[model samples]
Target: MQDLTKEPRLSKKQYLVVASMLFGLFFGAGNLIFPLHLGQIAGHNWLPAALGFLVTAVVLPLLSVLAISAVHAEGVYDVGRPLGRWFALLFMVLIHFTIGPLFGTPRTATVSFTTGVAPLLPKSWETGGLLLFSALFFLAAFLLSYKERKITSAVGKVLNPVFLVLLFFLFFVAYSHALGNPNAQAATTAYRNGGMSFFNGFLQGYNTMDALAGLAFGVTVVTAVRGLGLKREGSVAKVTAKAGVMATGAIGVVYLFLIVLGSMSVSHFKPSAEGGTAFNQVVTYYFGTAGHALLATLLTVTCLTTAVGLVAAFAQDFHKHFPVLSYVQWLALMAFASFLTANFGLETIIAWSTPMLMFLYPFCMVLILLSVTAHWFGRDPVVYTLTVGFTTIPAVLDMVASFPAVVSQSSVGVALTHFRDSFLPFASLGMGWVVPAVVGLVLGLGFHFASQRRQAGAATSNDVQPDNAD
Candidate 1:
């Protein structure tokens, strides 16, 4: 085995290549479809909506990578270790599970089915069609991720450009054809109108789930950086930050272009119930049957690349964290779970995952912010524990609040709803945890400083020692 402890380095050209790989990993799935739907719904308000989405989708994910890099940690699991071992393990497991088999992996197959294949298939074939498509999708992804040591090669080298070329082609046609006036559709309730548009878009961007995924992906990204030979901790962090910049810059442009496409198509297309449907409608209108083929091609490539990256990262983490299962076994488990979930259909998968997302995202945001600002509060474990602990009850409340009405109206749900609504500030706005987290952070800081002073005073007294040593 290679000495993992030894340092490695990369050249400028190789650096960019790996950076491009990061974008490829981040750019698939929601990166392709969500903004299009946002644009359609936002109508004339798409600009502000896009801004909002960018903050959560683009900004948060980038911050997540940087924060992980900043700490010189291996992954999100490491990020949580300072808080407590159990908490760290719990947080890590929840994040990986959420982004792995539960949502991210399965969505790749389901999304590819809807955006690429479903539009072309006969309506009668829908259920069975999804079954077959996802099976093939997961199989290809599993095999590639299972066998590949250089994970970036397949996704970065071959698949990314294939997807992007189609994307650029669509961007061209979307802007040039004037398929419909950009201002045709009125901004919907989901858009929340002009002033509120940004916040609404911000909320909508959470659907990308990239920020949470970033925590998981940091492990893969750092390993890729090291694999290229930049092995010193500082070098690793600096290089990883640069790569993160490139990834974000590239994807940011694509997301902006996609939002514009979404807006312009509004005049030409009716609002579809789902983002993928809107994507299908827009592509079909511009290119006809050939367009559907191109879309399916694009969706399949993007989804495949994403699934490969996710499974690769998940398998590595699970095996490292829980050693009973070897890496291959973990990969098989992920593939099997993802395959099973994908067959249930896209909406079903999303509906089931929402509660989980609600439970996880708040703490993730807390962790990232704390990781970055740790020095300011003396890097105290108390700080992490306070912020994250305070975040849990509200996060759980949000999770319960988001459940389907059948459950939300139950006794447990009724109690959660009352606690969330009656006491939690901005609970309905999806920020109920913010104040409590800050309060915990402040209290933690106070405790930290007080402890420091006491230590300092004890040292002073020990130095004097009332001449006992003499």
Candidate 2:
């Protein structure tokens, strides 16, 4: 290995480039769509809603990156290891699947298709269009990710800047020519009450999935930092924190702008089915039919960079664990699986993803918070086990309640939903796990102190016995 002592810290230029790469990895499909959708829903209440969205989408994700750096974890497996080997393995698999072929990776393609290409085609052509688009998308991603070490250069130096330019240009035009009066737009029923609106926006942030992405992308980022000649763990962690802050700070600003743009669009156009369509409509309004090409280019470039990062991260982690497959083989498999899932269409993918997110986000949030504070608690396994255990029941209930109406309306679902709402605090707001998790943390801390005291007493007794014998 090269001498890391030569450069313990990244220079300012290197930091910016790395930060841009991190931003590229996080700013994909959900990042674009969710804020816009939240804006429309929140309307006159957008400020509180946007603030709430930033809590989960930006702040939590930033903390997650720092948590990985804090614990010096190579990936999610290490993050979950304190719970047990088996639990760590299971957590890793669930996270990769959620952020990989099952949901997130495919989402980039589907979102791109929905926002960029779908409008250009007839309604009947959507299925075939998505298939073709996603296939090509994953293929390009695979090719780029093949040279894993080049991911930062590809995304940061090339793709991310282009996406930003296009995105900012759209923002400039939208603001220059006011679309409508956001204050005049009535808030949606879900957002009519300010408190509920904030909570709803908080819950909606779960849809971005960046908090999960932060954990999943940890390995990729750590490796990049190491490549930059940072051998010391503390140096790596510090650099990671700085880069994460820079990257997420940019994402936060974009979210605010998108939410405002979405609210403004309400004057000129009714809210579309989703943020993708709303975004598309805004571009069309500004640039006319030709805007279709601009929107397509913007989304494709943005999504492709994320696809490359996700595929690279998944391949690296799986190969490290399984060893049965080469990194390239894992990359190929991930790209193909994501391509198949993308053909399910954006709406179907999103519908199915909501429940999975509800189940996963609670566990993820608990794990991340515990890891960040582990230093204070001595990194006790008991704390992790208790916190995660307490969070699990409500998380499962939330998942069941969030299933598509067809499944959630069943008798069993109805009973479970009733029980959850009756027993769990904030269940109606989609944050049923918060109270239980805090309770677990308190109980775990009490046990930790009790155990510590017992150990101290035993040591004192032993020391006195030796003195008496002497």
Candidate 3:
């Protein structure tokens, strides 16, 4: 392999352009619209929700980029080394499936359907229109993916900027003119849980799946900057970090602006709409039908790009691991799977994704911590296993509790309610998992180093005794 750390460097202009590309790659309008809906529903609790949303949506994604940069890691699984290859591959496959067809592709269809198809259709034509529109949607995605280089870049540069500029315009108008009262309380059962409400929003943000995607994208950013003459791994890391920081800052600004817009709009707008619906109303209120149309187009394009990039990556990764499968074959399989999954619609996708995110986010966070902490414990597997084991227990219970089917049980479902009831720590909204995991990591490291010292001492003592006998 090439010595990536020894390559050339990028200029300031190239760095910023790299950052812009990074921002565009991650910042789909679909991501933006969801927050507006979350905010409108959250109302006065928007702060907590927004804070939570930023963790998964912004912060973790940023860290994911850092994870790749820290080791010049090629992908998420590369960084998953401390966990073992098989474990990493299992995770990589799960992450790819979740972000690919299982949740992602269908989301593209649904978001595109609601934004593009639903607005023009009546109640009578809804179901058939959805089926027709999504079929055509993925079909287009399939065809365009065949000529990927041209379509991906064209959409990225042309359609993306237009969408972003229009979005800023809408946010500016909404924020400046204001809506109704800015101080309505959260009425939903989800928000009634107190401080944990914010965390719930945070975890919900993970469903966007951007953080995991960002890890994969770090390679793209590095490669792009490298093309511009930045070759050294350190330089690439520096540029990538700067670009990630810029992208995160931009996302943060937009999320904050939109949440405030959603919050202030409460007096004038009812929280009847879910996710993008409330957002579309706010857009239509300001930009009218034409504005809504433009937003729809942008979302479709944003989703298209995300869908294509995800498909391309999945195919490439699949081929890399199992060389017998060709890229085209994998792409076909993925698009087909995505088409079926997409039919499930956005509401269902979002509902099912929550539990999965709750389980994975902590694991993702732990991986990030371990990658950075590798040298501290001498990169010992025992330490890794101990910390991960501690983390998984609470996360597993949280996953079951939050599962869409069980979330409504009130007892965290029937028999499980007894489990949580007996386990007091699990009762406090699953935040109980965070502290113990951290403690386990700390204690595990201590034990790892202590054992290592004993082993080294015994080896030295044994060697010295041989000389004494001689």
Largest TM-score belongs to which candidate? Answer: 2
Q: For residue 220, give model 2's deviation from the true position in Å.
A: 0.7
Cα misplacement distance, residue 69 of candidate 3 (Å): 1.2
Better of 2 and 3 by lDDT: 2
lDDT over C-alpha atoms for residue 262 of model 2: 87
Put down candidate 2 lDDT per residue, 123-173, tens digits, no spaces.
999888888888899999999989877888889889999999999999998
Q: Candidate 1's residue-wise lDDT over 1-470, tens digit each?
A: 86877665567777777877777778777888888888888988888988988988888888888888878987888889888788889888888888899888899999988778887889999999998888888888888877545777887778877778888888887777766666655778867577578877887777888888888888888878777767788888888788888888788888888787788777767776778988888888888899889889989998888888889889888888899999889998999899998888888888878788777888888899888787787669988888788988999898898888787889999988898989989887777888898888888888999999999999999888776544
Residue 355 of candidate 3: its Cα lDDT?
74
Residue range 1-470, candidate 3, lDDT tens digits: 97755655556765555565666667653476778777777777788888888987998888888877777776777777777889878888877787778886678778878765688779898778878877887777676656434433444455556657877777668767778655565536676554765866776687678887786565456555566666567777777778888878888888888777777767767775566777777777887878667777767777776676666667657766767888778878888888888777778887887777767777788877777667777778888888888888777776777777646365646466457546646455556578668887988888898998999999999877745544
- Per TM-score, what order, best first? 2, 1, 3
TM per prediction: 0.95, 0.97, 0.87
Clashes of each: 5, 0, 7
Clashing pairs in 3: 5-233, 7-231, 7-232, 8-231, 52-202, 106-342, 181-267
In model 1, the Cα lDDT at residue 364 comes to: 84
Q: Output the worst ten-in-a-row residue range by lDDT, candidate 2.
A: 2-11
Native-to-model Cα distance after best TM-score fit, residue 162 in candidate 2, in Å = 0.5
lDDT value, residue 250 of candidate 1: 82
